[model samples]
Target: MKLLLTSGGITNDSIHAALEDLLGMPVGEADALVVPTAQWGHPMCGPASVRGLVAATPSFRHFTALPWASLGVLELTALPTVGKDRWVPWVEAADVLLVDGGDATYLAHWLRESGLAALLPELHGTVWVGMSAGSMALTPRIGQDFVEWAGAPDDRTLGVVDFSIFPHLGAFPGNSLEHAERWAADLDNPAYALDEQSALTVVDGVVDVVSEGEWHLLRS
Candidate 1:
């Protein structure tokens, strides 16, 4: 799988171009499956927020709002109940997975429970476009500072990637670079602090940054 992890979504021309390069085609020619599962686990998100995201409202323009050949929702929360036979094809058939942001632990838990984590190794060409906690779910740890779901055992996640991520740098009052420095101190691995216009791409184990704004790689 190819990973395009973002603090915000595709917020700039450079990131958008990188996404197309990863897709191996134009965005308008690709099919996408939107994953809003993480939203359900967050206290600040509910039906309305998820609706806004899925519907591609202006507030979520950085994410699901993009134009694609086809767009569908793959709710991870509902995957287990329906059986993998049905859902697997849906995932396999899509060109990209637009994973939205929310609680990383919760999203990680459901990814495992839904068997998607196990299935990842087989998705040779799938592009996983993740934003915020969607991106964090792939890292080793999110740092307890980013944990919002009370049900999470700890800050641990899938660790599909070696590093951690501090998303939305400076987007919120508490997400400044100084705040990211504080968060990185407690983490044992390398990490990146990404601003809204930045993103990181991992393809075949090689990583590269795609940014038009600001980003920092905080080495462990």
Candidate 2:
């Protein structure tokens, strides 16, 4: 699997170049499916938000928003059966699956319940790009602070990645480098703190950090 995890979306030349390299083609030629389900119920989850996100990275000529929130109420057991007709085709067709940030727990719930988690491994050529909460949802567990902030019950996550991600470091009301350092100190698993200009790239299973901003890795 190929993943680009960011605190913010593509914000610099290096990140853009990395994405281009991952695509193995011009960004304009790629087809992207933007999943803004994490932003669901928020005022920013509408068409305007989609437009703004797409504008920030104008490389993809074809962009489609797949609001997964519509299926949020369905039973988790029903997801695999229902998703075949509704989401499978879209996921299979896209070259990129761009997940937007909002509430990580909310996103994780839908991803699991809607069967996206089960299908992700089958997306052979697709690039998974995540911003903020979207990035955090892919990890084994989220920080306790973030779980509390999101008003969620637990820090458990999708576990797509073995470690945890502390995003928006040094630039937010949510987190700072100092805070991340404190959090990492207590964690048994590897943790990464990333600022807006930085990203964590995973190709197959190797991890690489790319940044124009600040980032840190904590392992104990």
The sequence of per-residue lDDT tens digits that candidate 1 reaches over residues 53-133 is: 888889987778888898899999889999988999999999999998989999999999999999998998899999999
**Backbone-clash count (model 2):** 0
- Stretches of candidate 1 exceeding 4 Å from the true structure: none
**Each candidate: what lDDT?**
0.93, 0.73
TM-score of 1: 0.98
Off by over 4 Å in 2: 41-82, 148-151
Per lDDT, the best of the predicted structures is 1
Which pairs of residues have clashing backbones in candidate 1? none
| Candidate 2 structure lDDT | 0.73
